[model samples]
Target: MSATVKPRYQQLKDMIIERISSGELRPADRVPSENELVELMKVSRMTANRALRELTDEGYVTRMAGRGTYVSDFRAKSHLLEVHNIADEITRRGHQHSCKVLRQSRQRSRGKIAGALHVEQGVDLFHLLLVHYENGMPIQVEDRHVVADFAPDCLSQDFRTITPSAYLTKISPLQEAEQVVRAVQPNAAVRRRLRMADDEPSLVVIRRTWSHGRPVTFARLHHPGNRYELTGHYSPPGTPKSATGNVVELEIYDHE
Candidate 1:
């Protein structure tokens, strides 16, 4: 560690993230208490307290008055590729789907978003964040970045009435999509929006689509693991003349 790495508090906060990434920490697992961390890491009380405080604020740990802090679930394991709407995905499982728009704004791209869209350091980008409900319960939180080049009229649409998922499909047919999945704890802001419990785990899916050889949009969909699942089917070509059995399985990254 560098002498002037982040503050001890931030370093401790990062440690929680590292442990979660390594599976050393897990959802519902009680994290080391501030006193425990101080004794183990040989840090000051203030440093230990800062780490726990930040972790709680970041939604990486849940702190109880009398009980110790517990780890949060930050990974989505079930991955599948299928063309379906967010509403249909939930309703298929006997759950109702509802969405609430928390924010819709126009901003310039930054960091990796700018790089991915191949735009300048600051280019107009449409941003949206929504909370999805299932059977009157929050299930998924969606955060998206739109490529203005493909959907110039997106800003004019009213997301309060129509979902981004539905709107995008209505305007453009699927050309190509890329998706990725990983475990990530919700930030403080997202945690509250999803109404996630202290013990619940969260899954994040990042998707990007392209049309006319140009990037169309990017989305990050977060799901509560306890109530969501993804499924898909596929068949291989030229699979004839099978005496007993000949089957090939496929793996699809649920994205875009």
Candidate 2:
């Protein structure tokens, strides 16, 4: 029996991915062109192109029409059970996080927003739309509305320097939190802001927080599915013992 050998294109792809994982190639760093790869690796242009094409499809790289291929800016996973600031999450991954306040103003709470915040349909509410980026790549679109009375200064604060989640936590203690996760195809506006393809689905997390039994904030966070994921670890209660008195370990993951 002989060991199987990989195709030249696959070998090339693995080499490039290794560079990326090793920190030798960073986000936005241009990868070698197909012609350059062909010259350096002594492979045909078709093989080189296939390697780059596969990388692009797998979300490891992106190619521009006029420009060249560059390493992709991918997502950093954050636990769904935790209520941490997005800036902190990005920084924990050793990447720079930036926020762009797309829109911030006082708007009348209406429809679903009103219901979620437990406010009257026509009552004034603080609305903030923000786009958060990691290493200069857009990763999340946060559309949040706060109960006006809960955070009186919500509309006046500079969200670019401080995230809405952090600001809300500072103003009031979180007594309770509720979250709903779903997979959906983003709307045109959201797709444009996230810079994702029209057919690409997104992971949407709708979170509502309350302070002292009063609704404080409701937020809809959208993350591109290919670039982001939610993960959790759980252990069963009451460890079981085997017949021989050996301890048993149990772990479960719910991908619901």
Candidate 3:
């Protein structure tokens, strides 16, 4: 399979960001209008609009009701936590990454689905179900829900070529996220899809990602316990050996 390519909108975003990084697009400088971008990049109007809208949402640009868009006095936010892309991880491990998209559709959120995305009940949303593979072996099953408004083009992407994770990151940079990890037995269908033994449990990570102060995506990611392992390293402040330490320190915050 051909290597996954960055979406056109993301390419446009990268171009503008590179300009900003190189000091060509200074803060408060007028950014090219959507029409200008359409003419310059040869992308569709929808593509130009999405790129700019996402840039505004990500604080890379500011848009005025009447005036044109302009570069913002943007301060990049540090990622308090890192969310690794599965495809990148697989490639780093010298393995091929691929996925099968099982379900992709729009639906109304109900019950826990609504609560998970932090949206009102019955809000229309996009749902995706995928089974990820490493070297042709199934490793994970991901069930994801995205806020429809945040990703208007969610339904059109050919997910078999690009992962939902990669696509969503381009929608808007992650502002915040919450995660819950658990070990449990998944449903028979998922277990079979992962090729797990009947007695094996699954390692599950339930994640909710926020952008522009709104939860935009909620996902349940499951891995076969027998074949998958979770690893991490912690480098705390002022620790000489922390950089290479395998021990992770967890912080507990008081409700007060």
Best by lDDT: 3
Segments of candidate 2 deviating more than 4 angstroms: 1-84, 235-256
Lowest lDDT sum, 10 consecutive residues, model 1, at 234-243
Which digits, one per residue and each the tens of the lDDT, describe model 3 over residues 60-121? 89999779999988566443444467788788789999999999999999999899788999
Q: Residue by residue across 1-256, what tens digits does model 2's lDDT show?
A: 4678988998999899889989999999999999999999999999999999988877789999779999998664232354456788789879999999989999988998898888889998988899999998888999999888888988789988889888888887556888898999999999999999879999999999999987889999999887776654422111123323533444456798
Report the alpha-carbon TM-score of model 1 versus the true structure.
Answer: 0.57
**Candidate 2's TM-score:** 0.60
Backbone clashes, candidate 3 = 0
lDDT of each: 0.75, 0.85, 0.86
lDDT of 3: 0.86
22 Cα displacement, candidate 3 (Å): 44
List where candidate 1 sits over 4 angstroms from the true fold. Answer: 1-80, 235-256
Winning model by TM-score: 3
TM-score of each: 0.57, 0.60, 0.62
Candidate with the larger lDDT of 2 and 3: 3
By TM-score, the better pick of 1 and 3 is: 3
